[model samples]
Target: MKIILSPAKKMITDTDSITPDGLPEFIDKTTEIQKWLKSKSKEELKTIWKCNDKIAEQNFNRLENMDLYHLLTPAVLSYEGIAFQYMAPSVFEDSQFEYVQNHLRILSAFYGVLKPRDGVTPYRLEMQVKVGIGETKNLYEYWGDLFIAENSIENPEDIKGFKRLGYAFRPDLSSEIEYIFERKIETMTR
Candidate 1:
């Protein structure tokens, strides 16, 4: 199976802190961050693409860096006059271990193994979903899942079999993302 994601866009912490090189500095204001992100020119993107390609070639297991730029690095999402962080499937997975921002993994329009229940459509709209097992679905069905808080979640779309927070996004993430995926694969194997 192959996994892909978007760029690792940086966001300023908005506080004074010592850098890894032990430099004292303070990060305040979103405009500063935006300027930094915009500083990357097309040449930089090409350079990064070459470097990331080498890394991918060396570490063949990781997903490929196919784009010249982080294409999925969409403009920042603005909510309530504040900029909420952007969520890219590639980026979210790359930084999933960091566990900072939780989001739905988009699994639509790809050639990959396994998929979420129902499909990726509902998950993309931020709606709850119910995935089904024992079915051989294509890439469209493999968006994985998002766990909304109890009572804080909205009603799921028309799909059924998507077990609600019946599981936790704890240590066992594979299960948390798609509980039915394994069974579906096993069914296919049979």
Candidate 2:
């Protein structure tokens, strides 16, 4: 079974950790997005990133010198959020690493879907950002069902099993074909 995880906003270079197995599946599409990002001014980027001037400047520099292929870090080790800290890839055994490499996928605004060992440079783009690219009005439009279509389950009923992870199916919160799964903070803390 495949498990999808959200990408962290905070990322770091850790080429020393685990070597990336390959590039992201949608590198060509990522290149197109990168080109669009490169065209924006720092101020424009700050707006799009919804970050402070300092963060904007840092990411602006990263954008200017970004190389998608060289000095890459494995996606699992690159992200430095609380979730990643809890997972602690640094201490993972070989068997655990192999399992994650096979089953885990990270969702990214810049790279779309990434395997655990996908080579990725540090980038700052959120899926919710409203930046226009070509004729697309926003990142959601630019991505356009790629995530759902590529990652969809063969049977809709299969998702019900995820409730074991503390998620409750929220039919009231769901819209049309979309299913919303939510867990209480108390459940999450456990």
Candidate 3:
């Protein structure tokens, strides 16, 4: 029962007691997106991110110096937004941590999808951001069904079940985003 989640804008830089089990499965793909982001001018990035000067500059610097292979925190620890705060994975018991690591995945504009224990760096790309990859014009197009396809989950009923679990467990996540996910999941189920 793998559960999909949204990435958080807020992040935690301090080291946690838990060590990340591995790099994200889509590290190579994430690097591809980062390379494109790295190519953009700071102003361009600011406009694309639709953020203020400080956030734009900070994320620009993060993009410039980011080493996808190093200095990574586990996804559960890296995010510090409303949903993650509520989830409180940092204080989970060992068995609970293992359970989450196996059953959870976070969807990202930059990283595609991440396991709970997958290593990640701080960045500020939203799932609906207007960035393009090759001919793709947006994150959703770039991701397509790759995430669902990778998971090999094809049942519409299962997708509905997952959606219900997501809404029930992470009420902090936007209903609009969940609606989009429902549409996407239905598309994948077909």
Candidate 4:
């Protein structure tokens, strides 16, 4: 079981078909991420899912607004060997490029790996983050074709193609904003 992230996004226009998990495993299912998740009670699932959404939404807002706070953090994959790529729900609904940008940034920065697609991004941005996974980097292929894969995988070796996993802005940097204005004022007065 391993986690995978790629940079090739396709339109999953099927709303009705989406599973209760909100994500159909059209991407990585390195290890039975769903099954493991399902082991939890419905309440626990809801709690974890919503909490992730809330924090992601909040941080995404700040990152998008503050052009200066350019950073990325290792998304701390909840369970290893269970890789996936995702777009913030807000961006996925509408074809907002910001979502694309942030999605790629988040993925690439954390995984330090991505599959390159020519038309997905312009030359400049693409060139900036094309660093492949480190030689030591380990990932299991979870099927390359996003549109294929009948919602999940039973075989581990079938994953071959790639998906869109973007590079994060700067992971180590903090998203928290500090009020240095007061400190500056005090220093000047002193």
Best by TM-score: 2
Candidate 1 lDDT, tens digit per residue, 22-67?
1111112212322332344544433433445544243222122222
Q: Estimate each model's TM-score.
A: 0.16, 0.79, 0.78, 0.20
Give per-residue lDDT, candidate 4, residue 12: 20
Ten-residue segment with the worst summed lDDT in candidate 1?
A: 117-126
Could you tell me the TM-score of candidate 3?
0.78
List runs of model 4 lying over 4 Å from the truth.
Answer: 1-12, 15-29, 51-190
- What clash pairs does model 3 have? none
lDDT of 3 by residue, 1-190 (tens): 8776787787765446677888888788788799888889988899888899998888888888887777678888899977789999878999989998889888888888788888888988976676667877778668856754764768633433334323332334435334244223223353
Off by over 4 Å in 2: 151-190
lDDT of 4 by residue, 1-190 (tens): 2234432211122223211222212223312333333344544543543446554444334323322111211122121222223433322333443333334322322222332111111001111222223332112222222322433654533322223233222324423331111101123353
Error of 2 at 63 (Å): 0.3
Candidate 1: which stretches are off by over 4 Å?
A: 1-64, 68-146, 149-182, 186-190
Taken over the whole model, the C-alpha lDDT of each candidate is: 0.25, 0.82, 0.75, 0.27
TM-score quality measure for candidate 4:
0.20
Say what the RMSD of model 4 is.
Answer: 18.4
Sorting all predicted structures by lDDT, with the top scorer first, yields: 2, 3, 4, 1
RMSD of each: 18.7, 4.5, 8.0, 18.4
User: Between the candidate structures 2 and 3, which one is better when assessed by TM-score?
Assistant: 2
